[model samples]
Target: MGTVDRRSFLAWLSTGAVAAATLGRGGSLAVAEAERGATAGEVLVLRGATVFDGTGTGATADTTVVCASGRIVAVGRGLPGGLPAGARVVDCSGAFVIPGLWDAHTHSTEITPTVPALHLVHGVTGVREMRGSPATHEVRRRIERGTLAGPRMVVASNTLDGPDSRVPGATLIETDDDAREAANAARQEGADLLKVYSFLPRDQHTAIARHADRVGLPFAGHSPSLLPVHEVIRRGQRSVEHNYGMHLSTSVDAEDYFARLAALPDEPTDPNWWGRLAPLWEREAFRTYDRGRAGALAGLFAEHGAWHVPTLAVESAYARHPTRFLDDDQAQERARRWLPASLREQWRARVQAWPEWSPERAETELAYLDARLRLVADLAEDGAPVAAGTDCGSPYVFPGVAVHDELALLVRAGLSPARALRAATRDAARCAGIADAGTVVAGAHADLVVLDADPLADIGNSRAIRAVVTRGAYLGPTERQRLFDEIERAADGSEAPQPAGPAPASCCGPPPE
Candidate 1:
């Protein structure tokens, strides 16, 4: 919970000067010995917080949690007897303590300079980045080396899509050999996971999955148009993202629906292909949702140990209140703070240039989103593992802040507050295959959030962050505020920038004919 002036903070980041010489794992002092600091191997105690350990054991009150060497050393009723002589202690009499939250989906690169600081202030200690680039890799490297302050990151390879892919810099794969080559190349670049994208052919998807499995990398992404949900799960797709092909699979006319989708050209010449097809997808999927089939799919997910990252916050926001997401002045200003000026204007131009939705069209999309949400509820009720994800870096989806919104949305989808919290914490960790994070327990990483309010009482309280401890680097209340203040200053310092490229179209809206 240390505070530094803005100039000094920037200096510290560039040069490795720290006020405390705290030890990291293996008793290596992470900083030079300094005055008035906790000694090497000394405990740091958070005393008297109501603890939600993220394992669903419910809350334990008046507990003391101790950290040393970046790991939780003990959790008990009071400071353990024979505490170290120089233990650092923080009073947490009425605070709520939980494992640090995870945003199961995020995107980061040089364009988002404030992403790390923004995420830290909001207590997002871990992120599952949906795509990777050299810039993104540099960001992770700095964070892992303690040269930057940010979340623990797990990055996927550059997206693998068919030739008509819309994503910038996507690897275009066609045949099975192409997919295998791409997967091997990504693995060689040290990707933590594979991100298969829309329009991937069935044979290529199979080849990528087989190669990822052979190389011990878990594959999780869109269910390709030709791959049904059940088939994806059966083929060992680790996690399904964003409810892409799931809607078709839950409909009564699943076979016909999937067949229709699969029959589309592998690489459509029209740039508006996905947008043009979205209405049909929404109409049929929402109208024909078979509750029985949804229930069965949920069971199948559980049986196969598959997981879901629904990204409810982004999709529902776009569907129900597109204006709030796209045109809100306050949100735009915040985005400016968190993203570089050019990126901010790029996002703004996209919103301004997109075709407008009629009231009826908006309502229809909302109804469809609600149906999708109900499917999430059904899946959770049937024991299908769910993780909270906000597609941060998509238009208007603010990093760090949106995950809390996601948790609330999950609660609205019929999960208990406790269960919703788990989706962002424990279940999210398990889904990402990260064993050491997402819990506050002995030997776990000391990534934790201390809140002024009880999250179990209300999911919104997850945002009431009083402090965040990530990788044992503590950001006290003052430090957290400083982070936000600096982000605002950075944004305010910049001149407005010109848009970088063509205005982006809406995710579901049709292109101009």
Candidate 2:
């Protein structure tokens, strides 16, 4: 139960001491030999790693985990008898194992096959696709049926918006009947949840909420701009994505802000009118933030069991700290290399279109960013549930890799490394309503990340992925590297990207400000 030094542990494993001890007794060596000739679906035994079970608990050192049939069969210091016959054994000494990560808010269906593989390569085992359609459903099906090697998906219905919706192809709800019909259609389409957008009418949103409850589907997305945060939570929105509406709701001038927002033209002259005005309002909110109000809001979230997926990575890309990632030449180049040609072009044009801010405006934006980070910290302090999300498939929010950025930002916002990891693992699964995932316990899905360094020591160490075990199959360094190479080649346009059917409606309009 003592902390093991990484160097010493690796040295011990390198000398084959741990391996010998693991296989020296109980005929484990014979089992290992049998595993070499076994086909896929063989049991996977991971030995000698420190395990963080994703329950906000202390790491357990020198643990062994057994996986079979896509479920964790056992987790202990050592097997009572021996390793299973025909089980593939991975020596994980010096490594740290945690439940596979999840990006709880993603528009993955917008950029299909590559997005999924990219997620897997970065140790993401599950994703909540925010905008779902037949294409997303098909992607989920392919992943489930083994035709695609990708993360498990929890798909949401196509975005339901109101008249003059910003998102392309959104299902417009103008009446209670429209809401009910949309809900029923989402269920019929096999969506795991209903996705509501910003522009929904209050009555329609209420109707949708009722219909979602009737259809046994949880509804989550941007808090309708017309509703107050407390009302949204009370109305049973399962999770709020991107912290939309939080700035206004937590401001001391909340009532005034709400009234002004409500007074906006029902049909604005410009489709992105809100986007253009959001920064000014957000700055005002930050300047007038009231901790008491923010604390009360966080308390309401906890009281109602509502969750927050901040998607801080995308928020920073668009507003808080755009230059940090968007303006970094190296970062842009790296991201572009992973994006398809069309998307790369689109991102370039979008970035080019951003306005040049004055010094005062830049300072205010940074202050707003600080205010948002403070709100996140307060939410955590108040015991409000927070989950990690990248809002990937949006401009500058690269799938897979953005999860790490989100984690780092979460830590920067005052979560401990363990807490941030839990946001991406345990809390993420809970938010997505996935019962048997985001943990390393018996009966949980056998999805795990093995890291070369302790993530608890530093959240950034999460990117030091040594291997990924998903659905009882291991993707060690070589396999993961191959996946990365394939994606890179596809991004390079050397090979045709495998189509993942029709793309879901683009939900990246105007960056949601």
Candidate 3:
């Protein structure tokens, strides 16, 4: 069988059983109810809300949704005549009901009490954590046990990198045997997926991919610098994280570009290596971007069912417009109240330490981002799935709030507001292979958000959250405010400062010049 022993294998099954048991009681009953069907005695009716339903369709105004056992049992202009006894009814007139959002490229190793609280307040009901350490595993266990308030997490094992890997706590694979063992270990650790990183040797990466397939663990994350974009997709990388290697693939001279990268030291000794190499990579990508080749690549992505999590918010924060939030009064306020002081200071330090970016170079970076945005739109238009993610936990990328900003960026890049919503909802669920989430329909999870304004009118309206529902547990405006207050308290320095967790690695190459 698998490399894991019988005892551990049985324990894994027990964990699965625990998950199933937890899904059936109290606030989690909706999950169990959805499967068997909600009866009249246990129904909750939301009346007269405009429902977008996360189907990438136009909204239906003045509609009612009947939820029972955590599933949307019915959606129509009005509810059935006489509801069941003890049925709960909520007046949702003037509100907009949509599927709960997902941040598909989160890093949960950064969890503090403040992190999950912020995410729930923002109505991000789910996340796909890109890397998982023992700390993250414990956090997930607590969330599952209902001891913590957080998004549903689908976790990848601690990232797998090669000898020259830069991420702290990463598992290094340098040989074929190492690849197999690592994949097996991740699966045994109960990871939902394997996060492959940059810097892996080609043969080692291939070995990992093969072993991952054999172990039934899907792999996603960085496109190793050693491999071409097409090769990564063809080899069954379920999704590409960020906009690095794929963006590089737009170049007609992509091979020459990679050859130049390969010639550099595997582990650059200079702290300024990022500052030195970033401008050149950007310049080459801009110079040789070929629309025909890009379209061909999009076709391949569609054929292979390879998804993309373009964490445009984090990229924009550091590259195209590093100074955008530097002086914003609201950002400053949030930084003080909601973000840990150490993390906030780290962000400011990184910014202050960077050399000046000239206006000309800044404009070039903006132009390159614009080009990549166009490519994103084109790929989705050609039926390649695109998911919205903020690369949360990265410097200056706030956990919950950045997803809303990412949606706005997606719209600005050419997606309609509905299309952008789909990226964070339906498309993100697809990316994670989560069948029960990302929609407001029969048999779906009951996670949802009630917005004060219609997001279809403008994605920015998504921030007008009136309430949030997670697994059928409702968080009204009062409750939501309490969550924010709790976060503020938790983040304040009144408590002892937590030791900084290892910084997440940048799969996206150096910041733009």
Candidate 4:
């Protein structure tokens, strides 16, 4: 894995260069104050934009949204009364307003304020941190206390796995006692959820589930390899990340596949045994997929209220379309220019390490990707809740920007543009168990994105950000440009940041012994 110098990154952010760049010209003091949540009594109005409220309803035209004290006070066509005195109003004519997006799965806090700041720059106002540590906890605290300019964060405990854990630093749960202790520890540590991994023993997994239930902490992540998907769902996994076991579950030969998986050695000789094996399993599952079985599975998810976060962006980059960076010159250049040097080098090494695929193998992988996309469509059709997540911080998955890519992928997978938008906004918020967010309405957080074009017409238009309103601060074109400039400077190493520590393990990579 790559390493980042977080201390250096923080130093760069604190430097006068950044401050001067952001505040020197075209910067609003009110915008700066609002970002720090110091605009307690200030009112900001977004007028004349069409509002996509994220409630599955059609967009409302000519809407006016009033925000104060970091919350939306009113949203309507025209306030029955005139605007409040001393209110700062933005004329959003011809723009489309939508709820700020959420990256439902991220390890961004490992990089601290840099990743979080990028999320804000991309109009991602909230994130669910997939793995939490003392550092991440402190980052969240700072964001909430108005001392940091970042997104609202929902953090999960460090991953829990069985003996011979795939990830380094994961809490190993070999016995029921260990499971119970881990669950309680997560709750005591104030984790938003307890994250489980694929290698846990069945009994320990069950114990953790029950204990989390009793302790009122939601448990989520990969379905344990020792158990069937139905059993995992039955045990009340709040959300399944990456559609880990679904392809097998929906296969016509699922029982046989499960038997084969169960017979594999628990302690494999190869560290990435599962990673090497999963594609073969997925390809076979795709060929044998049963529509009836898939429909039933989707129905079960809906009935149980289990949410699915298909982080297709990372999956595509690393698994299904490993050659994307090699094939797309523009993409390669963008990644090289944007990623920190260490991270870029690490990702390049990983990509080069992939075995060269023959034409037939490449086609097979593409077909498997198609199958996954169809699976998402089937789930959406069957009323199974689907949320957009990019699995950012993984190899080749850029933070913040990938959320938009995931939305586009969802649309390509047969979801309407509006439904895709909801997956990133309302559905993502619900999946993360967050309240009073992900929608534009009275009493919700004043987090919004103003787009130059209608997102409902073209989900790609989401990238056409005219302005961003977060923490009751309106970051118009000028403020937004300043932010982009600062990020560029940091990315180019013009502002020297010192290396801090080892990079967190990639969510998709093989665990270190």
Candidate 5:
């Protein structure tokens, strides 16, 4: 993995310098977005229906939640009893309600040019952008002020990697001193966390980590090629990204940082096939990160209490998709319509493909992934404070609908639907260090959801959403339908965001008086 330094980070904070002069800016009026979201919070009522708190306490049916001013003032049976003469009301009709979903891992600013596409449409109430450029600073501003209609934004500013950091939009680094400076710069630029990239030298990673600790900014990203997976955690990186490093620690080489690093190059191609094959194909499997080892690492983190945001959703996408979801006609149409052509194009290109193991080498990839998954399951079971994340809707990953996909993958890994939901919801909140949201309880934020089906019965049912609430403003029936209508059009290949006026003003209807 590469280390970050302030100079590259500074350049990132000043994005136009690195980005191409666009063919032309797209439809986004980004300048107007942030100021728009600062509007007053509204009132919402999620009446009746079953409620899952994402707290593993089973659930309660026929509950009531009254929200206004961005906080819930009351929650119980028949809140506000009868509304005041002009107060709003919404009947749940016995659907299920739970905390809105979250994707701990995401590449946001580049997903779609329009603010509404991410905030209003996708079900993700919160997401962590694993990789971004300094341009993303605008993204944070817009979402915070409510100019954009997307989920709450938590960014790592830019992915930090080596001088040849494999990505066009990342902040590249090369030394420990550089890493420290970079961490400071990202922190000053308002980044929520330090997103480390894979393929860095072990010692440099350690140095960068020391910087992260000194600056009070938690570090989270890929494991280093040269370091043992447990060693990096022991050194105190807030979290491990995918199970990427887990395999590196157990690989044949004794920290083959440079050699193996090149093998796992950003792109899958290798000019020297024979040379690469010797080291890569001849690589040994990573069997496990037993409780003893994983626990020790977890213990170190618990002491400083770092977090782990597993982009588990990406694993499933790679396992089931061919880079982008474009292969699926339904998914493809959706991207072209709602997404900026540039971003949509990014998803389909092979160069942007996630790491893939050939179909002929299916078992090999599966075995490696299985080992990683097992360790994650054990971590969750052992209370490792994990968060659910996705690399979805970034190019080939579809937006507005991938959160459910992530939840199902978690269930398959042995999480009860409730536990899996928490990974996305409650645990994600903890990872981001935000506590005022993520639950539908009174005195909390009025961010909530109404599902037509029970997600606990089947994680996929999370998409059976009837209503959505951002802050205290609710997406009434008409508005929810409008969002889905846009989705249906995207899947079928039609126009992009239709001219739907402002979202509806009811969730279950308005809050009862």
Candidate 6:
């Protein structure tokens, strides 16, 4: 596949307004706002906040974020100078405001209706859903029309899995012909990318990749069963959806975990987790040493330009903690109370399918889980581009809410706060093909969040959201109140207490220069 170099991509972008607009995957009414700059009549301004643009730009304080239509017209100082006479103003004086975030890797069978809560509650403006169904596009269309509130989705058609696997909702492939056919189908259906799952023959995987590239789509996902990790990456995989599948494929624990599951006479021959396996985690406990082999996967991924998406929280909540996540004070209520009913049913079934929910399961998986997390760190240190995604369909993955948890895990994996935030915003934007999101720069979309606290200080400061401005619509005191009223009219407990009050004027927290 011919890759778009960054400079040419930028040149193509600067050609015309329409060219830039075309790059935007319109979401809700915000697309219209993004096309037009913040003009006189109806602009939203966030004055005087520190910006953590996901581009590793560090933090710039005393800046103005001007929004009109829905896209940003100005960032940094001296902006909003021509704020069309009666524009709305949001004072973010003592706050940290940055681009809206993305949950880059997600897995779902059906388009659960409750994902809207994820968008509204978390500052998540977009998501890349790995496994999608017919209803998935329908849901996306509904959200695009503003009939429903949900994250802007970059959806792939479905897994082109190995022949015998019986992937739940994807278009299946058994032969190279099937892979090519599937590629055409995915391209024609407006699928942003094509995913090759485990079991696809190496030839089929390459065929799918060739077909996708020919059609201007990116091919990514699980490394096929027969192809070694390097071969898959060198073939131009845009991303690898999960972390462990490649490394653990030939390792001892893999055989024990998969082959020994049913015929297990004793615990497992692998001493991977050993005494520790019976403690912290559950089924995924054992992690044996295959340092030389595993390290190669990282190097190969880096050399081949593949990014890593670790859905650490999703796996942890569903496969490791078992019932504990449901009881987690910060997570379960949100999942149960807000997740759409249909998805909730799937969640119930998922939890039920786990191995006997015993304390031992957690023990078995703990060491491996920790090891996997260390794997994440190793990948990062090894220079692999890593991102955060919460596969919300898994048990206890409350949408929007869980990404904060995902970020926490990423930070735990040795990413600095700035880097972790970038993985969520800027890095994901680049990977998912979104333009200039995750930063506060002129000409970027005006998807902004004002935090009451500084995230770079402790990382958890991301939770201190004082206001949310999606597109050019500023969620100052009055608008938040209106949204709250609407939410309340729709249902009880829809309203979180509004922030104390608006900050000072002049967007930069002082008079405009």
| lDDT of the structure predicted as candidate 6 | 0.61
In candidate 4 the C-alpha lDDT for residue 472 amounts to: 78
- lDDT by residue for model 6 (427-475), tens: 7776777776766665676677788899999888887777777655556
Which pairs clash (backbone N, Cα, C closer than 3 Å) in model 2? none
Each candidate structure's TM-score, on Cα atoms with residue i matched to residue i, is 0.87, 0.86, 0.86, 0.86, 0.76, 0.77
**Between the candidate structures 1 and 5, which one is better when assessed by lDDT?**
1
Tens-digit lDDT track for model 5 on 1-513? Answer: 122233432232123311321211221111111112223234355667687866667777777665545655445454433232333567886788888666777654443344335445555677776654555666667767876556777777566766534445455677777887888888888887887765455556776778888888888887654456667767777667666555445444434633555555343265443223322422243542345555655555566566666566556555443543545787666565666554455456642334554564556545655665666776677667778776654445554466677677778778789888888787777776678667765445567778889988888888877778776667867886676665445433432332111111110011101
Tens-digit per-residue lDDT, 1-513, candidate 1:
233333432233223212222333111113222221222243477888888988778798887776755767556564434344455789999999999999888865333347766777899999888787777777889888887667888888888877666656678887778877877888888889998876666677788888888778988887775667899888888898887778788888888876776555444565435534643574567678888888888888899888988998877766754455565777866776666676666666666666667787777777877887898999899889999888877667788988988998999989999999899998898888898789887667889999999998888899889999987666898888887877777664533322122212423233232
Candidate 4 regions exceeding 4 Å error are 1-40, 80-82, 270-279, 319-329, 332-337, 492-513
Which sections of candidate 1 miss by over 4 Å?
Answer: 1-42, 109-112, 265-267, 270-279, 321-327, 492-513
Q: Which stretches of candidate 5 lie over 4 Å from their true place?
A: 1-41, 82-86, 110-119, 250-283, 287-304, 320-327, 351-359, 484-513
Evaluate model 3: give its lDDT.
0.74
Q: What local distance difference test score does each model get? A: 0.74, 0.77, 0.74, 0.75, 0.59, 0.61
Judged by lDDT against the true structure, how good is candidate 5?
0.59
User: Scored by Cα lDDT, where does model 2 land?
Assistant: 0.77
Worst 10 residues of 2 by lDDT: 25-34
User: Candidate 5 vs. truth: CA RMSD?
Assistant: 15.2
- Please give, for residues 1-513, the per-residue lDDT of candidate 4 as tens digits: 112133432332233322333321122111222233233366787988888989878998887776777777566664333333566888888999999999899874555445667788899999998888877888888888977667889999988887856577788998878888888888888899999987777888888898888889999998876577888888899888886778888888888887876666665576445533543676678888888887888888888888889998876765554545766777676566555666666667766665666678777767877888999999899888998988887666888889998999999999999999999998898889987889987667899999999999999999999988887788889988887766665664532222222233334532222
lDDT of 2 by residue, 298-339 (tens): 889899889999888876766543444556887688666676
What is the alpha-carbon lDDT of model 4 when measured against the actual structure? 0.75
> Could you give the C-alpha RMSD of every candidate to the true structure, in order shown?
7.7, 7.5, 8.5, 10.0, 15.2, 12.2
